[model samples]
Target chain A: MTSDNTKPWLRAEIAQWLREGIISDEQAQRLLERYPSTPEPVEYGGGKGVFASLGVLVFGMGVMLLFAYNWAEMHRYAKLGSIFFGVALSHGLAALIKDPRVSSSLHLLGTMLFGAGIWLIAQVYHFSAHYPDGFLLWAMAALLMAWVLPSLSQCLLGCALLTLWSAVEVLEFNVLHFWALAVLLLLQLPWAYWQRSPLALTVVLMLLALALLVNSWHLQEGAALLHACLLAAMYLCAEHFSPRMSWSGCGSVFRRVGLPLWLALMLIFSFADAANIVVQLDGQTGAAAPLTWSMLFVLGAAWLWVLLDKSLRPRSPIQIAECALLLLPLLVLAAISGGVHKVGMIMTAANLSVLAYGVLFIVRGTSSLDRRQLVLGCGLIVLLVGLRFTDLFESLLARAGVFLLLGVLLFLAGLRYSRQKQRRLQEQRHV
Target chain B: MSRLRAILLLLAIAAQLGTLAYMVADKEAIIRHGHTVYLRTLPLDPRDPMRGDYVRLAYSLNQLYPSRLPGLQGLVPARRGEVVYALLRPVGDGVYELDGIADRAPESGVFLRGRVQAEAVAGEALRVNYGIEQLFVEQGQGIDIEQRQRGEAGFRRSMEVALAVDEQGRAIVTGYRWAPLAISVSPAPEIDGAAATPRLLVQLKNLADYPLAVVDNAEHCGVVLTVVNRLASSAAAPCGRYLVSREDIIELAPGAVHRFTIDLAHRRWFVDGGDGLQDVREFAPVSSLRLVYRSPAALQEASAEINLWRGELHSAPFSLRGFE
Candidate 1:
């Protein structure tokens, strides 16, 4: 309080200003606070950076070693031990690293070593005739690892290798192998779902289907049918699960394309079997009348259902085309059942119906159509009509005539439409 | 309201269309052609009762084993998409000589040839003649139906052979075609048809790749039983019956029929000692005799006795059809 000129923590000049009251004590204090703590020059050291870099080098060497140790040449026990050691050591090293970049790199290396080790183990077990259970154990281990490291590539690798092993086991007529593979597939679904990995989901679904196919051979008719039904169910489940994942652009495309393709294939497969049912039942029971009539009834009902449903969602061109195509085979079957002569009549009628629909679609699409809609609608109509006429006019002369007529008409229409559109646009601009 | 109603209506319509489509697709015709008859069914496998893996077909429609065909020596220029047909001339009973498209006029008995086509359908252009393949009892039942039901039938037997021919129609047999197959026929059962002639159900279960052909003999005459019915047994559980319920028989080419006698009369007619009326009463003959058809490689001729007592017929259990 008595004007201490030698301020305890301040420089001499600053202390004088505080004592004379040239500057307020608060300002002096503020100035002192702003001054650097240490004015002395400091020396530099690169120790930590060097140490971190060394760690990375060691991890890289370990990766090289991991690759060099060929699991294929090693005995089963050695392979198993090596895989265990490799996975543990690499993962542990990864966990100890603190730097994000270094840790992620280490994690990746560890996962690769782990995956290679597991795959090697599977291969060894797969080839070993004495140890049938080796494949199952390997599959289980891979499945467990997938769950533990959901984001790691190791998970997918594990799932895939396990799937292959399960396939072999199934082919060998091992029921246990079939169920085990199924379980692994089922486990991958949720993991893939949780991880939002569409790729993993797709692979798992495909593998499941393959396993079903292999197992279907040993099964009885009832069992085989059941297996097919199960496959259809699994596909349905996949379709349901797909929307939940953060699909990539390509994945989205596949979802759009692949789902429809898969569904169409399923429909074809189902229809093929359904068609055979009529013939099979007729032969077995020697009762063609009931079977034929029932088939017709069923076909009619299906046609009507498709037409009504399609009318409701008129926007979906694919659905409309599918429904229409589905009707052709049904009509053909009906015609065949009636007689060879009736088949001819039905073919003509079907041709006319398709042509009319095509023309109507073309007109509507052209009038209201954007370019894309016009192209799609006209293209579809032409294709349908062309296919129908090909079937309708069995004689080469008639078919050639129809084909030429259609080609000329389509060209003329397209040319006229373009010319008219251009003229209209020019007139509007002038006005 | 309209949207919801529309959705419901759409669904109803779809269901109806699906049902109708299912019915139409299911319509199939079972045509009987020549000595061969065709029945449409969801395809079935002809499994052998004894062998777990193979089936014994009722008829042979597959190409002959490559070894059996006379002159398929080396590779021939096969068209890319054109189906190649081979004409097989019979060398002996159940044996055939093979000729390619280039081969000259051929003597014929029952010729088995195949066209390799782009697709399974009748018109799919054939690619080449691997060999003289035979048709199985149940071949191409419906469009795509055979492939669909193949899984349920277990293992399939394919005729293995390679055939080649020069432009002159002269054929050289390259190698003997053999399939890992076993074929057998059940003894004719002793059941009287509504017509009183002993009705027989002969099953040709093809257990191997070689198409099974039983030369129909003049002695055995009845509708070649295409539809086989399973006669009930008293035992709750019976084993060794591969085709327990029903099956379709494969059709054979005309004039290829071989004759064999199926004796309907029983060997024993009288009992030695019994009750006074029973003693005087003669035992009526009811046992059935049938010809057994084993393939060319079979050690013993395939035959069986189907014993009938009081109207019940019993067949002797045999080994798996293909293995024997």
Candidate 2:
């Protein structure tokens, strides 16, 4: 047999061999069918082209008719009828078109034109002091089109417009307008599922949540707070349920970066709340609430550290970073309770804890301490120590002196690392 | 190559034409057309100056209403978008009746009606209930006269009417109805030679269409000199003239004529040639003059002024300063 035919025969022989004893019947069938003959490419510009052209013409004519009728000036029902008819015609055309290229392009153009046409009709009606019933229709059509196509541009436009319309309706004090936004979010889900588009889904969800928050704020204060809390809780739940579904990164990096940031914000808010309570109490009863809530959150963070230590893998950066974050709130609480004088004691303890963690991380370098982890761990230790001295010194000049000393230590460390690398390279060359 | 370019050009033209056609086809029909007249009214009750003499009237383009469906509050809230018509049934002297109804719902309040179904029939009207307290006559017939002679007793009148809006959005006001207000006209003594300058001259003539009475000591009004252009070294010549009661000038009958002259040359003074002439040359100035009259009843006071610098004529600015 010729070279090409030899390859095919060998594939058949292997398939028969697998079918007999080695591989299962299912495996043999899969291998045999894998090399099916290629189908002929589809030809363009025939009956299909004619049909598509006809479809476009029909859709365009329908748009013209809808425009001529001044559907916007008609009653709400009539406007809804016209919009539904127009959208149905456009979508029908999209489905009937056989060629992918023609289908996509036609779908884009037809939907856009239909949307713009409806918008124009509404505007005319509004300006003429007539009934403007086209807005609802346009919103619905845009959302449906977004789901049908799921093209990036279409989805983005539809989402943005629907969100804006919802906001406008809310401002007009119509609570029912939120349904349109809900519809848009629902439409996005299918596209997200189909493409496995996690990033897109996240962004769209965040935007939807934000819209809900803003609308709630306008409608009711308690509602706004509840909505925001729900959105944050949802994110946290999502992170916990499927850790791999976290789009940001692997577990360690996200925990190390995300935990400290989350804790810091919580601390800031707690402090602000405590300050307000103290001031208010001083004005009224001359007794503060003892910063009890803030202290409780701090204690909660400590409990979280102990829990993480037991649950997480030892020497995990996430475990270390989470512990550090959990300790930070406690430090702040101690400072607040004992005044500035006790800050130095808290800082010293934190510094020693951080240094010990850093040394442990360095020793575990064979597994986790890459360049980034090494820098982050050691840098954090130095930062804690430096912050302690700065707080203890209490004067700008003395603080600057402490920073200068820390900077010298970092410079020496970097120099020593480079020297060690050079010695290793030289040793390798001599050997 | 040229054919391809031509085809592109044709495509662009076609697209533009399509857009233009769409816009034209979608253009909103002008449902109603009417005039808006604004006027100030002074209330007859003397104790209430807060009810100023002038009442501003507005003729709206369209009246709007909420969508008729229940539970649709705050949706399309602006009422200026509904096609509305007002039916004015004549009430009595100085007052015509007003019943505003939308073309879509006749029983509705006089407010604009919106969201009428597409299949709605004609003659359906909506009512708008503005709850306005008073109505005044439309403005536009009697001439607006600024100054009248003291003790002059005659009447002045003005009128306007709202048009009827039909089911098909047609607006029609059938006949010109009269809105009349009675005013007592009076005449005042005119000063001689009020304007006699070569560059500028002003002549006051009695042009009243009805009989008027002129009185002496009817409270002489002051003439304000807005600007004095220059002071001649010669004694300041009278730049203005005021009649000393009724004796200074003859009483003017309807259509009667009067004249006055002011000479700017009399005020010019030739001093020692050098410094005095320089001062005079440096001091070129302009002046404005206004005529003011006060009535014995304290109700008929008016002023007329002319600017000398810009040579522009201006009426005395109306003052509600004492009303409230």
Candidate 3:
């Protein structure tokens, strides 16, 4: 077993060492008896079992479909009664689940069913025109459930519902909705922090990114550049303020949310179609540009906090450079949509930056000896290369050749890295 | 801490379930015990896009003139889309009419809280939907209901919908009844049209036991084009360019089939809604041709004054692509 393997078979290793005269019998016995003799009230399993929970989700959906199928035939009270019964019954089942994972699954099913039930009743009562209003009520109810149950699944469901609700609100109206969303979410942020849930905070930041996206959709042809800027700023503020915000408690959860988002934005902005959105000069898009000021103001506050606080310095050069790259376009567009002139150059710069960022990620990951980061970096580079080939060449032959060439290069690189890692491990073992 | 969480969970469940039950119970009570009101609805109403599985309904009296309301002076609507409680008083036999709007729910009379969708200050016609603007049917049923309703002729067939409304300003649609069709109109076969002029085939089947009589002496009963564009979103889209009104009286007997032909080639055509008469040979390819003919109540020709339940009849949408 390697030293860094998360769960080590230490007892067996110690026993073997003792047998081989590396340690005394007493030492082996002492080490073996190290576990606590006391029994715990709630015993948690090692990891979340994904499959069991998935089964329950499928079953719950099946049940919901069953109700909707018989909707017209069923009695009005029976249809309404069944929903309450399902919610209560599912929660009742959740109470019996001793396994943390299965319990969480029950809670999720209960939450999803609750949502379905609300929609069903809404249909039954003919509240069809004002559909978006239902989401607000549903999200609020989920928040209450999250508070009472306090699980990852419940919090996640609530976050998603609220995010969707806010997105719809923004699409309905631009700045007015954006302001309402900001206030609602910003208020929820402290509550999430008080819960010491980094997942919750990450959800908040994620929802903000989604809400910010409404600007691009509602404002322009498809202002991917603006969306990228807003998202980058949001990620930076969250990462920087993590310590003060109590996001320090649950480590790497923010990374789980932010990295994929950043990658998606990069991929989107890499395309020429997205660039057209920036270059196309439309009066409506120009007027809507001021709607992003509230987000930028929040980011500015975070930057100000970093500058004034002596204890909290900026993390590293890479982040600062990326922030600069993100903010550069915004700074250029500050006159609010005159990025039209700078569009072509901005497109080239964005494409180059994404490729360069991928390379940097590889170098940083290799130096730190983190395989996930290295693979992720390599995967991104390979993806970008594949994208370029597919975009440039319509013929399948040219694309396949490029794929084959990249595969050979990646295989050689991986072989070399493995050899180097092996040599390092040998050196450490000898020491 | 675990015990406390369990208790909290119990309280939360109770609260949610309690509220849900309360709402549902109120609605159910309306269905069980409330004054029943019926609306005579035509099938050609437009639908809202947001509502996927439902049909958006515009009632004939959805937009009401303020003068119709007995106490209309007090009901100045402040804003649009505001949920206003509508006070409906019984005007005739088993028919309750929308009397007025109020900010607060009325303690007496059949009341319904509806969001005011559109208001015409000058026209004084306020359009409101009491959450009953939609009829959510089981998936593809909306299309079917719409087709049958539109395909039917007015005098012989009709559609009626009933709803139950309580004093608490709640309303729920209770039942729907589509009129029966005896004489169905369809497009004439293209093979027959190739030889002569393009015409419609009106097939009248006596689905009932009573004898029926219609116009056999007149050369034509009604002339209308049923533009069959499957590419069209609505059944009534192309029909707007055609026409909807005209009455040709006919009499039929029990267990009989009456077939009438209307030329689609070149003919003098009068617009359904408008009185403008023009020579139209333009209706070449058609899907459905609606035939409107009145039937005598008794088997005699002079007994045209009496109109019974669904005395009017129209045909289903028949298929036709091109005509000579």
Candidate 4:
């Protein structure tokens, strides 16, 4: 008898063989029985989950606002006791409820109440704490609740709270809080992996990028170049690790988020003012902070590792362009450190790189028949041309001629692409 | 959930509750056992949307002039946002003044732990922030207290904050009281010098029955004078930063008056301009003048034996017709 793990195609071929008289009917039947069709999966509670989550969100927000009302007339202890009671009661209800969605929602409500309790306690005592400390404690509570309840919503609340903590510190106090970043990497990253949540991981990636900027904000002069390199590195790292990731579509998601970020950074770098900051004019040369050098080195090493990947050789023009794009900032960085201060040359190089990447994307999209890539490519090119036309060129006649040429070229490309697509379809139908 | 998981969940909840309970207990303990002290302060109406309306409590202990302490001249400077310990010595019943500031916790003394909001060079003024700086009142009640603190007529000095400072130097605001102080401006009868500017003799009086201290330093000065022109435009003397010494503070007995002169023709008078402050070289005739005094200095300078009065006041508008 064939195993149950037998491929569907093998069973199909066997049935066909029996019909063609290549096998006896009994043999085909016996083989087919071993590979019995698995039952279709039953999806449960889709609408229920959505409604439950929404209810949780609304209920949480209401509870927070109610708490903020600061029941001033009530006895302080009574207020504190009521908040404590609400948190425990919601959490207890969550424990009793057997439905997963309802239980998760209840847990979320409990966590939100718990946060309110912290602030309520603060209000009751008229506590004038270092304000960020409140957020840190709130984040800790949410994270701990997330861990205990194993709830995704709670995890998200924790992430948001932690980000708020870091933001308040960096923006209000102008202090770079490393502990928040450390917690994100060490605690939240693992939680994302544990939950196998691609969305959570993406949020973690974006937050990490923000945290990196905040942490290295002291490196004012060298910040842009260092950030550009880091952004490119993140993209490469995501691409390289996507396949090995446990969850499906993780790589695609990373690329979807990362590509635009990389493009935006590169676009900004293409401007002269931003580019010249890589080598300051006032004579303080090199990366201003040692951390900048350390980051550049780490990013360089990561790129090298990705480049030396034995399985995926850079054979395609698009892949080669990507590799070059990754190196462009570092090359500029090196030039700056080596006393090259030609601002015009750097600006030209940055602009040309953006133009080259735009063209590469268009070519790759056309060949691969990916509409999203094609749209992105066209958008990028249009943005570059639009920016240049808006500010760079002064001659209206030259601008008009360029626009006319661009329109004609785009029209011809679209026409050729449609013809090729039509021919391919016809050939497929004939075959 | 299994038994172990249930226990773990209980533990987590207990841990969170414990953390909150610890905060409550900590503050309660301070109120229970900490030394009670009165801080001089004035309030302005400000609201925190999340936490309701609060009267921003500007205390006299907020800024300490180390220049007053000749002994601290060579000590290491505390940078902004760095931990600072302000040693406070009681000058009267339930009133303490800053004795000295150290970067570290003092070995043994009654002190309030603070952060250096602004660092000053040696022998200059540095600002210290005790965390209990904000007094969160009931929603909308802040404006009432603020209004009382900035009185309607000629007086504004009123609010007195009570704080409990523990041995560890942490503090929590406990309560507030009202102590009114007054400022009066009148035309000066005498102009001695040939080139003397037209002057007004201003008086800062202790309207309350308690002895009070006034900041007479060149920096903040005891009182600020503003001249209102006929068009309702006003020009104010710019407050300067000068070394504050023991002599800078004048102790006023109950119902006592301290007098100062304001020169209307001084180059220092500036009016608000579109770009910035514009020099008020001249003024329109028949304009009225007003004097305002605000001090966020300690109510008592223990070393100087002066009980500093802290509050903001606006003098009743005085007519400048005779002088002009």
- What is each predicted model's overall lDDT from 0 to 1? 0.37, 0.38, 0.57, 0.66
Deviation in Å, model 3, residue A208 alpha carbon? 4.2
Worst 10 residues of 4 chain A by lDDT: A1-10
lDDT of 3 by residue, A341-360 (tens): 55555555556656666666
Lowest lDDT 10-residue stretch of candidate 2 chain B? B303-312
- Give lDDT tens digits, candidate 1, residues A10-69: 454465566678899889878778543332121122455335534654664465445333
| DockQ measured for candidate 4 | 0.39
lDDT by residue (B14-57, candidate 2, tens digit) is: 34234434543433222233222221222111111111121222
lDDT of 1 at A277: 34
lDDT tens per residue, model 4, A102-148:
88888778777777777776666667667888888888888887788
Q: What is candidate 4's TM-score for chain B alone?
A: 0.62
Specify the poorest-scoring 10-residue window by lDDT in model 3 chain B. Answer: B228-237
- Chain B TM-score (each prediction, in order): 0.22, 0.23, 0.51, 0.62
**What's the true lDDT of residue A15 in model 1?**
54
**Under the 3 Å rule for N, CA and C atoms, how many clashes does model 4 have?**
5
i-RMS for every candidate (Å) is: 23.5, 17.7, 3.3, 1.9
TM-score of each: 0.32, 0.38, 0.68, 0.76
Ten-residue region with minimum lDDT total, candidate 3 chain A:
A1-10
Which of the predicted structures, 2 or 4, would earn the higher TM-score when compared with the native?
A: 4
Which ranges of candidate 1 are over 4 A from the true structure?
A1-84, A96-135, A174-185, A217-260, A263-394, A401-431, B1-324
Q: Write the per-residue lDDT of candidate 3 for residues B19-83, one digit (tens) a residue.
A: 66766776778888877876545444344332236656655346655654544445655456666
State which candidate has the highest lDDT: 4
What shift in Å separates residue B262 of candidate 4 from its native position after superposition?
7.4
